[model samples]
Target: MAAGGPPPVLGVDACRGGWVGVLLALGRPSVALFAPRAAELVARAGAAAAALTVVGIDIPVGLSAGGPRQADLLAARELGARRSSVFRTPSRAALEAPTHAEANARSRAAGGEGVSAQAYALRTKVLEVDAWLRDRTAGPRVVEVHPELSYAVLTGAPARHPKRTWAGSEERRAALRAAGIELAGDLGEAGERAGPDDVLDAAVAAWSAARVATGAARSLPDPPEELEDGVLAAIWA
Candidate 1:
């Protein structure tokens, strides 16, 4: 998997509300969104995983005590992540605890902005899910993506979207329509931008997937190490 060229890139925009996966091949990204079901994500990730190397998922891929806790955080710091982010704090106390899952379920059940933080944390579980994906699957290496820093890579500069939000289905369809791409779903209205925001995020996440897939994305890790708990070598400095 580590031999030929860089591995395919996989990007996951995970949240408590739901999660999205972007798989990019050649130079295009394929998009999928769901409620972050473990079994389903692994299955959905199959296409790009076959030839993957570097993955840029929009989730915090490590634990932290004060700062960014994951490998991506080191990347983010290099990329200039402004202001500290609670980001993907654990929803549960123990890694094996049900608190995180329960929090996720509760957030999903509430709807609205209720699950904002939990959504971020949901990526942790998704990361675990990614691990399971690799163990059973036979292609591509996967890595976590920090959404903000990822945008920096995508645009060649870091930019924050304070008011910007992920676009919903109809919104994405609208943008695709404007761009002359076929809409995958029916959008009941056009004035709504939130829907579009979610879609745009998914697209960006897809871009991350594509970059890692095609060797366009660079990894800071000199001698890349297999990810594990409490390993400083896991991150590039």
Candidate 2:
């Protein structure tokens, strides 16, 4: 750790075990392939994670825009993202990146359909998940992820996995891999996408947490309760 620097974030690809990757910003490339469920990821880390600061997730923490209702409008206003806009189901670009066709299939299995009968299942779930973490902690900067931007932040260019979109399978996985996902093992399976997305998003959120901790990415938007705590911990940890 650098002097006067917060602890490094654990950037997780949130994929399957085979592709379940973990990268800690403790310096040096500490990437790996150990797939763990989200609850397990937290419980397993136990005191260690509690001791740290942030968690970024690649999953949607809020619901998607279903037509244009009040909540949808409010959410869009809050994130500053429009309904069905580029950030629409922001995870789309993450999942459809362009490497693993398998991840898209698996992500669908995780309940995120490529389309919709009502609202986007995954997006709805993001709202639930976001609420879940918000309800649980007084610490850890927990936030939704937009991997296209995440890759941009990490690599300073559109370099992650070939820049994909939810429009198709080929593009999604490519982008997921570029974001550091694996195509065969843990990330390749169906049951793992939930935890994988959560973990990776947590990682990115953690990175943002790091920036805030360093007093570098100084931007603020009256976030939900406890979210700021998570971000600060992720950065300081």
Candidate 2 residue lDDT tens string, 1-237: 234446644443344332232434443332333433454454333343335455545554433222211222333443332223223342333233333454345445545544332224343334445556656755555544344444345545443233222242344444445544433444333334435344444444445555544555422122321322242111111
Which 10-residue window of candidate 1 scores lowest in summed lDDT? 186-195
Overlapping backbone residue pairs in candidate 2 total 38
Query: Which ranges of candidate 2 are over 4 A from the true structure?
Result: 1-4, 12-36, 46-50, 64-87, 90-128, 160-206, 218-237
- Per-model C-alpha lDDT, please? 0.44, 0.40
lDDT of 1 at 206: 52
Report the number of clashing residue pairs per model: 23, 38
TM-score of each: 0.54, 0.46
* Model 2 lDDT, residue 97, Cα: 33
Name model 1 segments beyond 4 Å from true: 1-10, 25-39, 45-55, 60-73, 79-94, 97-137, 163-198, 220-237
Model 1, 1-237: lDDT tens per residue?
113423344445444445555444443334344534534554565643564554444544444322223454356465664424323343222233346555545444434122344444455564566456445645444454454454555445555443154343343444434432332443222112224444445445555555556656555454443434543222211
